[model samples]
Target: MTNHIIVTIGRQFGSGGHEIGNKLAERLDIPLYDRNLVNMAAEQMKISPDAAEEVDETGLSRFLAYYASAPVDYSSYYMTNIEMGQPLSEQLYQVQSEIIKRLAGRSSCVIVGRCADSLLADEPNLINVFITASKEDRVKRIVEKYGLTERKAAERIKKIDRERRYYYELHTGKDWGSIESHDMLLNVSAMGIDGAVDALEALYKAKK
Candidate 1:
């Protein structure tokens, strides 16, 4: 394994990104960070993990303002001494940012999404990857995994990709899932999930 490796995977919905990350982490014998980041960040923020998870993907509209420094009690549920009026998404981003940096500093790990590639852009030995798939394959995967009709699956994928694009662009100012944003890009519909992981693992070793 490459020393001090940090592989960040930005993926399209139903592209098997999480599965790829998990396999890569296992093969590298390192921990994987995915939706669990929400819990970790929520814990640091002294809030319920469920609360953070709600805004993790789709984002929050009810709460506005990310002024952690201002400390105004605009809403009781959203106010802690340092969290008053803070936007849920941004607040979560700040905490997760700290955690991501700490994890990267500690040792090798695989991180999935949450704008991690951009967050750790300055870190050493980091491999930023974008995973994409054909729309037909993605829709089929979504339909099978979630028991949705093909049309609903397609719609969900669009909604999810839109949310991901908005979130990633909002924080990183880089085009989400663009060639410029990543060191490597893989089409899982072409290579398959395990095949993508295999290719990425080889790339990770060469990154040294």
Candidate 2:
């Protein structure tokens, strides 16, 4: 059966979530939106991609009050913010959310991070996924990937995971990796990338 499904992946830093997403998208012949999302948002907002990257998935506590008070016209919110001189972080979020919605409406795709799960929560065709891995496995992957010592890899994992958790909670008011937050959670360490991809593809087929 042909499936039109939007897979939103929330993953820990060292988890093979990105690899899985790429493989799944390839298998399904669908577009994969990851860091390219930042570029897309930046282009729409008429800002440098580097500017968007600065606040990508990082909490904005100091600017939340201002953002909360802004008038929200979902139709043109991002453009409105550009005209209103909103902070870059707020602008990026608004633009990216709009872009994600537009992309979902246009086609089924796999979106990695940037709170795509929560942003598209109301969509009927959405599949929310969270990817995690054992700490030891994550550390090992990080050490190998970055040529870092085990201790440094462990530290990096903790810091990135903490930032992800904080950003997710701040934006969605939901626990980052809590089982209840997602339609499915996969442990990359247990299943490995290819196995995880197969499982997700199977799940999508079943759901469709």
Residue pairs clashing, model 2: none
Kindly list the per-residue Cα lDDT of model 1 for residues 1-208, writing each as its tens digit.
2248799999998899999999999998889999888889878877876567656755322122231233333232453345366767678788888898888888889999988898888877888999999999999998887777898778878887998899899989999988998988999988999999999899788975
lDDT of 2 by residue, 1-208 (tens): 1235899999998898888999999998889999899889878767665456667774322133233464322323223354677766677878898898889888789999988999888887788999999999999897877677899778778877888898788888998999988888899888899989999898778767
TM-scores of the candidates are 0.86, 0.84
Model 1 accuracy (lDDT, Cα): 0.81
The count of residue-pair clashes in candidate 2 stands at: 0
Best by TM-score: 1
Instruction: Give stretches of model 1 more than 4 Å off.
Output: 1-3, 59-84
Q: Give the TM-score of candidate 2.
A: 0.84
Identify the candidate with maximal lDDT.
1
TM-score of model 1 vs. true structure: 0.86
